[model samples]
Target: MLRTVSVLVDARDRAEALVRGHEERLEAVAGQSRRRPRPRVYTEEWDEPLITGMRWMSVLVRIACSDDVFPEPARQPAAKYRIVTPEAVLACRPEVILAS
Candidate 1:
């Protein structure tokens, strides 16, 4: 029981550290942009972990935004997901055929 508690604590600490590091990087980038005279156009995406349950499951929080002056061009769209199969891989590389 004590071991399980220790593990949970460790996992929580690690998650917190990762979140802190990401936040620091974001701040650094923002600070650099502030120093520049011209407006910068770029998208920044980050995943925030939301720990839940006794086992410490993380839920991803994806956020994407751009700092562009033009509203029309400032739109930063979310990434699209695609499903790839073994057949597709084999088509590209006939030498390495995968067995079902």
Candidate 2:
């Protein structure tokens, strides 16, 4: 069991590093283009966890608005959801995903 856990942890770290590298490549590509400032992504999963309401909504909004990269949602409120189910949460959507 411990061995399995360690292997999984190592895999997760590798995946995160890959994602970060991809993002960096994307940023470089964007910079090379004549496009305006880069856009920010909400990058959330639709699930019950987000719906449970643990003040995440407030935090996301606050962080987005304060961040120059992330723009406000098109409509009055954002419709994106967060993964709450144990299975979904363990799906490894985040490098350091957190749930309550």
Candidate 3:
């Protein structure tokens, strides 16, 4: 069981790193964009059953198109993820919501 856990952790780290690398390359090529404000984004990993927000070290890594709504989470590293209520999400006034 320990071995399996270790392997999964290793794999998750590698995947996160790979994604970060790709994001870095894309950012480099894109360079800085206009000063216009970026939209606040709320992405959901799951719906119907329950609502959860994406929270991890990787969330700090910007993507080409996606923008994060909550800034506090990005500053938090030790935290993995958390469940959010609909009211909380609404309070953010996210310009975009990615639900799956």
Best by TM-score: 3
lDDT (0 to 1) per candidate: 0.33, 0.40, 0.58
Q: What global local distance difference test value does model 2 have?
A: 0.40
Rank by lDDT, highest first: 3, 2, 1
Model 3: CA > 4 A from native: 1-24, 29-36, 55-61, 65-67, 71-81
| Model 1 spans > 4 angstroms off | 1-10, 40-66, 69-100
Cα deviation of 34, candidate 2, in Å: 4.0
The digit string of per-residue lDDT tens for model 2 on 48-97 reads 43422234433443333322111222222534532235554345233333
The digit string of per-residue lDDT tens for model 3 on 3-44 reads 456577777666666677977876764465323456677766
Between the candidate structures 1 and 3, which one is better when assessed by TM-score? 3
Q: 1 or 3, which is superior by lDDT? A: 3
lDDT of 2 at 73: 29
Q: For residues 1-100, write the lDDT of model 1, one tens digit per residue.
A: 4445657777766666677798888677766655555422212122122111110111111112222212232232322222234343334332211111
Can you give the lDDT of residue 30 in candidate 3? 45
lDDT winner: 3
